[model samples]
Target: MISVVLPARNAAATLPAALDSLAGQTLDDFEVVIVDDGSDDGGATRAVAAAFSGRDSRFRLLSRPHRGIVAALEAGIAAARGWAIARMDADDLCHPDRLLRQARHLDANPAVGLVSCQVAFGGDARAAQGYQTHIDWCNSLTSYQAIRLGIFRESPLPHPSVLFRRELIDRHGGYRAGDFPEDYELWLRWLEAGVVMDKLPQTLLTWNDPPGRLSRVDSRYHTEAFFRIKAGYLARFLARINPCHPRVIVAGAGRITRRRAERLLDHGIVIEAWLDIDPDKVGKRVAGRPVLPWDAVPGPEACFVLPYVACRGATEEILDRLQSRGFVLGQNCLPAA
Candidate 1:
């Protein structure tokens, strides 16, 4: 059985659609554990969940005070009875075959701890272009190695689309409450603990990208917090791979990019130099490190290269260039954007 954990807070407006999608799933052997995280909608959210519970015996609702998503998710997980726990947000829609496909994949690949399917963005097209790009980039990383290599660059899997093994969460002590985004933090923690994860190529979920989403409003999901989280994980990963603490070369020279990279420096990771494609920026100094042209990048034996570039095509170009130079990815050159 697959337990679908749906955490809702002030989600009365969207809960029905989400619940309806779950009720319509092709896979019938599943339970929905809906945790109402203190919705102040005058019991409207509870009414909706209660209505679903009345109609579908598989749907269960749990009420709790406003303790945020981390706590709510934990509550749902604790109440879940399935071997695999699938996540569903109140504002998103799941494809009918999502659970069936994901569960089958897990049944076939027992070694994978977590798996997420590609997502389709459902909102204003103008505001969703960035999200669409993110979805596309994330979907490109379909293998465990690709996901691991790009984990620091971004959240390799969509949180709501994920189906996780119960043992995986239990082994890691469950979701952690922190000043950073919980989902990203969990992924980082799992990756740090050597948990194997992958993504399904099919888009089995529709992600709602509304303006008032938690990620947009919560300070904990801000850019700086993400950077700090990335830096912490990157430092640990680099130390494990290169115990000698080689001076690392950064691949972007922009001030904001450099500032983010500075977090790693604070963790005692030395910066050997910076690399950039700009002719004017070349031969200049950034944060006391010389900015060199692409051709001047140090060989794999000398130092490790980290790409901090965020441009559309630049990351692929950088990866190709590094690979062409015989610097194996995830070994000597890792993308850290």
Candidate 2:
């Protein structure tokens, strides 16, 4: 049997559609674990969850006090009985075949620890450009190697579109409560622990971009928070992958780049040199590390390289240059954008 862990807050307005889609799933041998996360909306959230549980024996409601998403998710996860546990947001809708396809893929492929299907951006594409672009980028990482290469770029997997094995949680642990995006942090942690996550090319869920999405309201999803958590994980990754452990050439020397890359220093990652195209910055020192011209960057043999830039398309351009000089991404050259 399969288990779907649905976590909800005061999501009364959008809860029904999410439930209806679950009830209409093509896969019948599945249970929906609806977690009412202390919704204070006049009991509307509980009423809606109770109504669904009343009609469908497959739907189980775990009424709990108002904790945070991490606590609610843990409650539902503990209650889940299936070998494979899937995730669903209270505001997102799943395709009828979402569970069936993901479970089958997992059944056929024993090597993959987690599997996420492509997701449709269920919002105005034109109005929500940044979110839409992020969704598109997440979809582009369809292979295990691509997921590893793009993991630091952003969350390569959409939270609501994934179905992972309970074994992964048993071994690596589950959603962590911290000052960061829980899903992204989990992915980074698991990936660091050698979990092999892959993606199905087919789109099987609607990743809605509602105005009141948690990422929009929560400080945990802020840019600085993400970078903070990323620095620790990225530092580990560099140490493990690079022959020159703890030593790297930073590929950007701008103020924002230096500020963000400085986080790695706390992890004992030494900056061998800073590569910059600017004449003024080339001879200057950032964090007491010399900034050199980009064309004079050391080869992958000399030291590992981290392309630390967040400009819209600067990372790709930097990677192209690095690859041209025998530096490989997810290998000697890792990106930190």
Candidate 3:
């Protein structure tokens, strides 16, 4: 059986549609754990969930105090009774085949611990171009290697699109509440612990970007928060993979890139030099380190490199240049935004 853990607070307006999709899923052997997170909508959320529970025996409702999403999700997952736990949200829609395909993949691939499906952006792409672009990039990473290599760059897995084995939680623990986005932190933590996570090629979920979505309203999901959380983990990952434990050549010399690089530096990782193709920045000193031209990049034997460029298409170009010089990713070069 597959247990769908969904948590929502004051989401009565969107609950019915989400419930309808789940009730209509092609997979019959599944349960939906609806967590009503102390809804403030005059018990509307509870009413909606209760109505669903009354109509469909597969749907179950759990009420909890408004402690936030992490607490609510943890509660729901704890109450779940399936070996496989799939995540859902109160506002997103799912394809009828989502659970069957994901469950079958897990049953067939014993080694893959976690799997997420490609997601369609449910918002207006033009209005929410950045969000849509991010989703598109995430969908491109369909293999375990691609997901692992790009893990530090951004969240490669859409949270609600994921269906993971329950043992993952038993072995690696569950969503952590901290100064960061919980899902991103969990993925990084699991990957660091050698958990293999990948994505399904099929887009089986529609990721909605509601006006009050947690990512937009919560400071814990902000840019600096993400960088802070990724830095310490990236530092450890580089230590494990790169022969030169804490020393790396950073790929960009711009202000924001320098700040991001500093996060790793804060974790004791040293920048041997900086890399930039621009002639003006070349032969210059940035934060006491020389900004070397791309051609001056040290060979894989000499140093591991981190391409911290965030500009669109720039990081990919830098990665291509590095690979052309025979630097294997996760061995000598790790690209980050």
Candidate 4:
């Protein structure tokens, strides 16, 4: 039987729907383990208990003192008994066939240790237009594409829609607290452990984007924090994959670019040049190196760092320009973490 773990912390407003969705899943061989994380209102817990009361023997609820999401998830992981462990957010809706499809996929593909499906951004009883682009981007991600693109970069497969083989999670020692970018950290750890993950080509969850969400409320969700984590992980990965240092070009003069360059420099990686598009920053010096204009950038064999997440569009444009100039990724230009 599949074990679905839902960790809740005062998610009263949206918890019931999630349970209801699970109740309707086509795969009836699954059990729900809801870990109530010290809910002050107690309403979310009661609602959850009431929703599953007397229905199925697979539904179980456990209460734990408020520790945080990571801790709560760790608790759920410890309590899970199924060979396959699936995660569902307290405020998200799962498609009726979500478990069946993912379980079938995992059963069919033993080489894949983890499986995640595309999700639609819909909530407030309706869909959001802004998520169309994100949804499409998520759906287009292939396993290899995810690997080369830096699993943590470009939105590594969504966490809520993922299913993990319990054995793999156990081998990795489960989740850890203070993992700033928790989801990314876990995915990267799996990758580092030589675990393969893939995305199912169907929308299986509906993500709810609400006002005052945890990300919007917490500094832990800040862009800089995520960027730092991703960069650190990438740097570590690169060091392992390519021990020999290559000439690296710091691709932006912004704060992020400079920060990343400094981190790489700390690792004794040589910085060949700083490339920037802004005329003002083009000739300026950062970290004792002159900033060169984008056009006057160094050879493609030199690694490039487009450190600023905000400059993603511009980064893509620059990559296009580099490709047009016959500098392809993994060959001519590699990402400098």
List candidate 3 segments past 4 Å from native. none
- TM for candidate 2 is 0.97
For model 1, how does the per-residue alpha-carbon lDDT over 213-289 read when each residue is reduced to its tens digit?
A: 89889998887888888897898888877633647888899888899888897788998889998888899887788
User: Candidate 2: lDDT of 95?
Assistant: 94
lDDT of each: 0.89, 0.90, 0.93, 0.73
RMSD of each: 1.6, 1.2, 1.2, 2.8
Which is the winner by TM-score between candidate 1 and candidate 4?
1
Q: Candidate 4, which segments miss by more than 4 Å at Cα?
A: 123-136, 152-154, 240-246, 302-309, 332-337
The stretch of ten residues in a row with the least summed lDDT in candidate 1 is: 238-247
User: Can you list the residue pairs that collide in candidate 2?
Assistant: none
| True-vs-predicted CA distance for residue 240, candidate 1, Å | 3.1
Candidate 4 lDDT over residue span 38-142, tens digit each: 888847575665568557678888788898888888888888889999998888899999999999999999998888888887744335443455556666776
Cα deviation at 239, candidate 2, in Å, is: 1.2
Provide the TM-score for each candidate, comma-separated: 0.95, 0.97, 0.97, 0.89
* Per-residue lDDT of candidate 3, residues 1-337 (tens digit): 9999999899999999999999999999999999999999999999999999998999999998899999999999999999999999999998999999999999999999998999999999999999998999999999999999999898999999999999999999999999999999999999999998878899899999999999999999998898899998998888889898788999999889999889988888989898987788899998899999877877899999899988878888988999999999889999878
Model 2 per-residue lDDT tens digits across residues 183-205: 99999999988888989988899
